[model samples]
Target: MLYPSNYVNKIIYRIKWVTQKNIEAVENKALKKEELKEKIRKNSSVNG
Candidate 1:
């Protein structure tokens, strides 16, 4: 089956956009985890 060039381009663009979004989400999650750990460390230091 043959597809139009524009249709193929659209699919490629969408895949790229979704992949970039996924990467950003993973990075954000890691950052949040680090922030949570830092907060716990600060609280423990203050209490101890």
Candidate 2:
């Protein structure tokens, strides 16, 4: 089997872009979780 260089490059570029997006999404979710936890802790301390 054979493929053109440009075609292979396009596929590699797309894969890299998709992975980068996924990594960013994961990071954002983690940050959101941390923010939520902090908010809950603050509220609890204020009440108590």
Candidate 3:
């Protein structure tokens, strides 16, 4: 079987795109968690 070069390039590019999206999702989730922790710390200090 034979495939076109553009077809193969498109597949590779899509794979990279998906991997990058997943990485960004993970980083965003981690960043949100850190922000939440900071907020909780600030609230606790104020409440005390």
Candidate 4:
């Protein structure tokens, strides 16, 4: 009854939180990769 509802809500909230965190982490990693690629491109063009 009441306990089950509370437990379900808590579980859902935690799942949502973890999912959002994982999405954000992936987005950040993609951004860093892009930045590194840009840096490498710039350096290669300079040396070549």
Candidate 5:
């Protein structure tokens, strides 16, 4: 039996795209948390 190569390539590409998007979302959440921590530290230093 023979199969079309393009169909396999398309599935691989979609899986890769979804994996990359998930990684980016996790990274963005981590970055936001770090920024919040820095802001809190600065505020506490000024008030103290």
Candidate 6:
């Protein structure tokens, strides 16, 4: 059986694309967590 020359490369490219998307999602979550921590600190300082 013969396959197209770039078929394997295309598959790898798709996998990379999916991984990048997941990484971005996690990064966004971490950023939000940091922002929440900052807000809590500010609120506690103001109240105390």
lDDT of 5: 0.97
Q: What does each candidate score in C-alpha RMSD?
A: 0.6, 0.5, 1.0, 2.0, 1.8, 1.7
Identify the leading candidate in terms of TM-score.
Answer: 2
lDDT (Cα, tens digit) per residue for candidate 1, span 1-48: 989999999999999999999999999999999999999999999999
* lDDT for 41 (candidate 5): 100
> In lDDT terms, how accurate is model 1?
1.00
Q: Quote each prediction's TM-score.
A: 0.94, 0.96, 0.87, 0.89, 0.81, 0.80
- Candidate 5 local Cα displacement, residue 5, angstroms: 1.8
Stretches of candidate 3 exceeding 4 Å from the true structure: none
The pairs that clash in candidate 1 are none
Q: What is the per-residue lDDT of model 5 for residues 1-48, given as tens digits with 9 covering 90 to 100?
A: 756999989988999999999999999999999999999999999999
Arranged by TM-score, best first: 2, 1, 4, 3, 5, 6
* Regions more than 4 Å wrong, model 1: none
Name the better of 2 and 6 by lDDT.
2
> What's the C-alpha lDDT at position 18 in model 4?
100
lDDT of 3 by residue, 1-48 (tens): 889999999999999999999999999999999999999999999999
Which pairs of residues collide in model 5?
none
Q: Which model, 4 or 5, shows the larger TM-score?
A: 4
Candidate 4 differs from the real structure by a C-alpha RMSD in angstroms, to one decimal, of: 2.0
Clashing pairs in 2: none
